[model samples]
Target: MTDEVAEDDYEEVVENVALCSECDDYMEHEILKERKVGTGRDLLLKCISCSAINNLQIREPKSISIPFILTDGPHSARVELAIDEDEVFNIGDVFEEDEMLWTINQILDKDKRKKKTILAIDASSISALRTDMVRVKITATRGEQSDSSSMLVEYGTKFTADTKIDYQGEVWRIRAIHTGAGRTLKGTVESQDIKRIYLHEPPNPEHFEPKTPRERRQAWKEGRLGYNPNPEIPKEITKKRVTPSNKRKKKRPRK
Candidate 1:
């Protein structure tokens, strides 16, 4: 009873489309009728293979530019994001940009009210924090002053107390770990839980100081030091002459 529908002028929507009851799976379908509502499409579709009718409503996706703010520790940068009008974003969802993954922590609706979830059409802005890496704060105490710096470490990196670490072109030992609960002098903690790492600057190692050439000569002449300038050069060897073929220093007492 269905007319030859291809002869009718209807806009076709070709997506890997909706399920068909007769085919019992998704198959090619032709749009018999399509009406565009404010944000959605009401479509009457007939399967090309089985001639079954399916009425479906799909949102017409439109790109909406929303403000996306990315946070890194104390700094933040704002960027524009083009999301589909139908996109629904939830807190704790991850988004990737510039090879970094960020987790959505907050979203603001058009009224600037905080929301746990938001549709792109209603979202005014979104805030996300870096999740793939974290900046670990480091502090080294001197006699009176303290030096503070930060290092970027992979997320969940384990840091243990009394371990040597490299920072600012110097080697430091992790004296303690502040877990935000308390400082621990021993044991391990992951990156996320650590608030700040207390560091101990390693003591300068003692080394032998070689005397200068002038000082060496002066000390040797003063009988205060032994000088060996060319230690690598072999020293001449002198052999003592046999004492007059066997003359005794003093005639041994006759035995």
Candidate 2:
């Protein structure tokens, strides 16, 4: 009886390096010539450090399929991404899929450890969020009158309280932002994480242009009377969440 040898016994490599035949050492080389062979590439290279000539045959980079978890607010879905094994990926990188753009928030390596930077082959899974567009809930108010609406904004749009902004053909000042931590008046919030935005009228309106010094002084006084924005705390909504009764099925009747 004779022992049989395994057909696949060598390690697969994706990097662009090869051993120099003349120097008998692995070294970085400049491509001198290249042509497509039957299943791979036939290439001639010269070592950069030793100036030695070498011949190398290489195959295409292996494809690595990684699990992609995409999220939008409370919704999430799983998808697969096929990337070249030699490609490098980093956090905050954006890629287009399913006709929308997504940004990488985190990556899990082969050991299931989180990482900010990793190679495509080393990444086991990825977490991403929609970045092309985000829906922002806004409330435009002028004391007694107010309008509540939602607007589509870019991912990184910044909103700062106590600043004036033009929206929906009207000028309004931001009053507060509701973030995951809570509502705040003096801090900035991104559009993606902003649950809601509160706004009031701008300090000066076009129709309120003052014709006299006294009118101007009065307008200034009115703008400052109740528009104190120094306080950062916001009133929290203490409403309790009620779970629907339909979540669990009733016990089956016994025969």
Candidate 3:
């Protein structure tokens, strides 16, 4: 009788271990145990309802730092810094200590040492002919030889249609329309050394008049001036006459 009682107690313990704690109901549960040779034993509890396993080991968080430098230049300024592959740095932060800062300053100073070239225009002569064609001669000098070019200007207009000019060794095409009072030249640099200049006329509102809506419609209809009527056709059906020889031939074939 005592052996039976001990067996009953053992069975009860096994049944309790197999029951799932999350569901509050009796269900099959798996026991997972991990033990390392150097580390202590670790036991993980897995819930069947959530399907989640608890991590037993605690891990430390890792972080990194980066350094940078900011320097000013003649044309523009920049920030230089040294950063690790894992490090992050914000803008305007200096990290290269003082060495990179001095290097950047020196580069900026050297760039500022460059001298800018100055360009000067000699003179421009405008000539008008009886044929209504106008010519403009322009001479410009930049350091050495004076480059000269000519453009044709139209009369009664402030801007020219198209004109090409060569300055230095490059050619420029004119694509601008000048509309300023007294300065009525439209020009653009066609190439590195050439400029194309043209003349433009001011807006003339008096030259155009708005037409009435009725007049516009009338004009549209009048544009199709010529019309032709289609010929009429009769709808009556016509019957064809049958020849006796043909009818006999058809009957003979059937026979």
The per-model lDDT (C-alpha) reads 0.84, 0.82, 0.35
Model 2 TM-score is 0.52
Per lDDT, the best of the predicted structures is 1
Residue 222 error, candidate 1, Å: 32
Clashing pairs in 1: none
Which model scores highest in TM-score? Answer: 1
**Where does candidate 1 stray beyond 4 Å?**
1-59, 204-255
Worst ten in a row by lDDT for model 1 = 232-241
Residue-level lDDT of model 1, residues 45-113, one tens digit each, is 999889999998887577989999999877899999889898999999998998999999999998999
Candidate 3 lDDT tens digits, 114-165: 1122111110111111223334444444345546556544434333335543
The TM-score-based order of candidates, best leading, equals 1, 2, 3
TM-score of each: 0.59, 0.52, 0.14
Q: After best superposition, candidate 3 residue 229: deviation in angstroms?
A: 70
Tens-place lDDT digits, model 2, residues 124-181 = 9999988998978888888699888888888789889878888888888888998889
Regarding lDDT, does 1 or 3 come out ahead?
Answer: 1
Task: For model 2, give the RMSD to the true fold.
Answer: 20.2
